[model samples]
Target: TYITFPIYSGITFNNISSYVGIQAGIAASGKRDNTITTSINGIASSENQLGNLSILLPDFGIRAGLILKLSNKLNLHAKYYQGLINIFDKETSLSDFTWRTQQFTVGIRFSIRNTNDCGTCPAWRT
Candidate 1:
């Protein structure tokens, strides 16, 4: 999941718009199943553990993305994120790890305020 704060918007051409923003969010890794087998004096035993094979946990990251407005309500978005905190638990592993991600999405936006209302319009709305 993520949240974005658009800081700027520009009219690239007639009926075309571009936006830039900062995003922050949390991400998680998929769970995995691992097994270990041991043998002693011709006897064998097996053990299984079901969970993440790595040390990744719920992680926080910052992101930046570009939104290309296809229409008044439709846009294409692409973003890159870098982890702000290492997801690796020191107690679990000795290696340092970080989580990073990239996203591409298409979405729709709605505005409650009228476009013609300029009383409280942001500078990017010009």
Candidate 2:
């Protein structure tokens, strides 16, 4: 689950806009049990009953996206998110873990009543 709050947006073209935002969310993973075996300093060792080898939950991230207006009331969007904090628990020897996500969306938006006429096509503002 996640929630996004758009901080800023601007028109890049006649019907296209770019936006930056902050997102807060939680990530959950199921549980599993396994065993791992390795040799340290030429000594063989084996560990059994290993579990909970997933990233930590309740994470936060930043999001950025582009919005392309398909029609007066409809738009298409592409977004990307990257987690700020490492969600990896200290269950393994490996480090450097983070969450990354991408999204494509189609939605509707309503504009206020105005009489200003900008007679331009979709790519004109560029």
Candidate 3:
């Protein structure tokens, strides 16, 4: 994932400062073990037992990202998260399915401060 932050306060654009960040997400597929027929006394038997398998594991163990400031009052940022999920039960006869995806985004910053506060002071101040 990627992100940026923009600060916009008092109509002024400040120099870029730590305003860029990056992130990465990864995932992997699950494996299953199958067993073949067994050999008996120099003779191969047709009967065989299917091997077992462990639960599908996810890869969201580490989620890394960054943040950046575009201006004094504005900020831009982004991040990404991911993990594997199995959608099948062991008892089910079907193969296990894994799904993955996680992410978010943010950009632009605004200030609610009164504009007059920074501009020329009140006029006609005797």
Candidate 4:
């Protein structure tokens, strides 16, 4: 499990908007379930479970995406995330290889009211 905080900036061109951002996160907990099987003198087999995995706590990533305004109250968005740090904390035979995260997400957003149509609001005045 992990939690992340993202900072994003967006610009709209006509009906489409583009965004780019950076994110930082931490892995709160990490675990793995493993099954180990062994044979003693080829007589019998035994099984055991290995638990808990060591994970690098800090995560850093970059995000870029686009949003299409389908309507005044609806929008479609897609984003790509690339992790800059390796989350794998284990050492292996291959010292030059590391694990990173790559993800692509697509979703829709709905708004009760379009903010652009609100004009000036008395409640928002400082």
Better of 1 and 2 by TM-score: 2
Question: What is the Cα-based lDDT of residue 36 in candidate 2?
Answer: 79
Cα displacement (angstroms), candidate 3, residue 86, comes to: 4.0
lDDT of 1 by residue, 1-126 (tens): 333333443445555555454544443345667788999999999999887645444555554555565554455665555556655566675666644544555555554554446656685454
The Cα RMSD in angstroms, rounded to one decimal, for candidate 1 relative to the true structure is: 6.8
lDDT at 12 for candidate 1?
57
**lDDT winner:** 4
lDDT of 2 by residue, 1-126 (tens): 344443545457787888777766664554567777899899988787746656666566677778887666556777776667666664563666554444455555544422133445443345
Q: How do the residues 44-115 of candidate 4 rate in per-residue lDDT, one tens digit apiece? A: 665667677655768899989999998988999999989999887766333555878788999999997776
TM-score of candidate 1 on Cα atoms, chains taken together = 0.48
Residue 10 lDDT (model 3): 23
Candidate achieving the largest TM-score: 4
Residue pair clashes in candidate 1: none
Q: Model 1's lDDT to the true fold?
A: 0.55
Q: Lowest lDDT 10-mer window, candidate 4?
A: 88-97
Candidate 2 vs candidate 3: the TM-score winner is 2
lDDT of model 2 at position 112: 42
Q: What TM-score would you give candidate 4 relative to the actual structure?
A: 0.79
> How high is the CA lDDT of each candidate model?
0.55, 0.62, 0.42, 0.82
- lDDT, model 3, position 108: 67
Per-prediction RMSD in angstroms? 6.8, 9.9, 14.2, 3.1
